[model samples]
Target: MRIAIVGGGISGLVAAYRLRTRLGADADIVVLDRAERLGGILYTGDVGGEPLDLGAEAFVGRRPEVPALLGELGLTDQLVTPAGRRPLVWAGGAAHPLPPRTLMGIPSDAETMRGLVDDDTLDRIAAEPDRALTWYPDGDQDVYSLVADRFGAQVAERSVDPLLGGVYAGSSRSIGVRAALPGLAAALDAGAPSLTHAVAAALPPPSDAPVFGGIRDGYRVLLDALADAAAARFVTATPATRLARASRGWVLDPLGLVDAVVLATPAPVTARLLRYVAPKAADAAAGIELSSSVVVALSLPQDTALPDNSGILVATGESLRAKAFTLSSRKWPHLAERETALVRASFGKFGDEAALSWSDADLIAAATEDLATVTGAVIDPVEAIVQRWPGGLAQYAVGHVDRIAEIESATAELDGIELAGAYLHGVGVPACVASGETAARRIAESLSAPAKS
Candidate 1:
């Protein structure tokens, strides 16, 4: 049987690997990507003669998918965790400790937001539990609307927006409560008295495990390993233009007829691929917007006096051009051994695409300037590398859950087609890994079924 997996991102790569394992030696699988290289946004570039991830550098370790995948690939030795350091939030012209016991920066109580917000905002938060909250069951809205209305705009801007910006590359205004914070939404739907109570109920139980994980070298190691294991024909710098029903199965452009196909491209690309085969799914997917981002990696002198914290997140309305700074040398213990200290400054957001057009020199200059402002340290970079990811992240806007449900329902009727990507369920590495494997399993099962007489 022949299978085509479109898009060479992590989701598509993982799907190809899973399909290889399930189908064994005889099955033919081809992986196609429009880019010259694979890994999609998970690109690793060099800085100061050492490999550093220019895209996502870490994954949520609390999830099992990443660790489990590493073990399967015998690359568990590459799995590394953070140094157990807390990240600070830069707001009000200073850096403050990131609030504790909060779900994505929505504090369970007023005290968690004490230093970050003003006294008036603190008073508002303290009294929030007593206010009557109006939340309809199974309803949805932007996170900013809910947090700002219930706890004052300061909480949403200073505390919540920074964290959301780091995750979605978009503000709370572009993310929805139901999809971004399902537990909190469930708590509200279950009739929680106030936002405070809902946040309290939704918070996960505390644990000592590291909250995030990364590869010791870079994501390139995993990408290389997955590619080798999948053993599929890799087609780079080529895009699959069309997909349609065929006599026996399906015809994927450039790849010809295949027993099955998995479209692991981004939301917009996936929507286009499904336009004729599944119009409803395509409509829902087309409504899902994307956000762009840029990462500027700076190699600094090892003796630079950066903060002891893991990283710094910028609050909304900050004058700095950068949104966040990941002190790679401080965040990852494995990177501390490098010759020069490493820092990754992120730029752009959902509606802000200006950084994407900036020259590498300009991006590096902005990163250097912003790092100085946030860290209050001498800014001198030994070397720098800039990577741009336009329309890289999917915005989980209001009614996102309903849209995903609609997309899935409409595509479920197809016999030999599957969809997987960061847009459907989540934007994290673990979520993408799971999506790919799930898609592979479903397609393998359908193809393995006996034909009706």
Candidate 2:
């Protein structure tokens, strides 16, 4: 049996790795990627002689998949938690501490969010418990609509937008609630009277375990380990442009016939690749929106005083062009050991493409300027590295859940074909890994089934 996995991102890599472990020695596996390098968005760059992640840096440790995978790769010891987990929000020309006991910016206790929201908004939030319960919408809805409806526009803009933007790199007003914040959606559907109370009820009891985990060096370490484990024929700089049905199974153009195929590319690319064979799935995949972003990593002088918080989430309507900033040195103790300070400034979102048009030098200048403004300290950077990810994040818009279901149902009719990636389910590293592994298992089962007799 031969299996061809398209795209060498975490999803593809994980899928290939799973196939290798589950299949027999007779099975042949190959991973095809368009880019020259593997790991896709999990890029780690060097700055001031220390490794820093340019793309996705951490995974939620609460998920068992990543930690289990790490153990399998002998990377359990390399897991490191953030030194400071609290992130501040830069709004109203100042950095305000993020309210505690909130789930993705949805405050559990209105009283705890005193300074975060204005007096009018605070009053509105405080009155939420007494407000009449509205029936949950039957269909999918955007996060901002649900949040703003319950908490008012101010809380939606100041709290929810920054947190959701930090995750999706898209507007909460546009991203779907069911796809992006499923727990909150479930709570709402259960007839929860208040958003705050619903979110509070959904959250698990506070524990000592760290919310997120990262590798000692970088996420690249995990990618390298996956590549090593898979030990498959890697075809870099060669993307599977077309996928079609063959006499026996599936055919990935230029890669020839394979018993199974795992499409691990982004939604847009996947749509194009699957168009000829599965038009319904392709069309549904094409409907999914994406957002672009740029991460500018700056190496500052050793003496540069940075915020003690993990990072600052730039609330919507802030004067700063950068959406957020991570005090890399402060957040990761491994980087703090280096002689210089490392900061990563994020720019661009769904509708914000102005920063993408700027040159590297211009982007650095703008990021640095925003850094100074938010940090309230004038500091010059010694070195800078800019990384642009066009269509970096998949925006789960309204009806995304239904669209994914339709795509899955369509793909189910096609033999020996499966889809997996960040676009399908959650966008985190763990979710991607789970999706890929699940796809691989499904393909393996289909391939091994007894002639369907």
Best model number under TM-score: 1
TM, every model = 0.99, 0.97
lDDT of 1 by residue, 51-103 (tens): 89999999999999988998999999999999999999999999999999999
Indicate the worst ten consecutive residues by lDDT in candidate 1: 444-453
380, model 1: CA deviation in Å? 0.6
lDDT at 175, model 1: 97
Residue pairs with backbone atoms closer than 3 Å in model 1 (clashes): none
What is the TM-score of candidate 1?
0.99
Off by over 4 Å in 1: none
315-429 per-residue lDDT for model 2 (tens digits): 9998889999988888888878888888999998898867887899999999899999988877799999999988888998988998999999888978888899999998899
- Report model 2's TM-score to 2 decimal places: 0.97
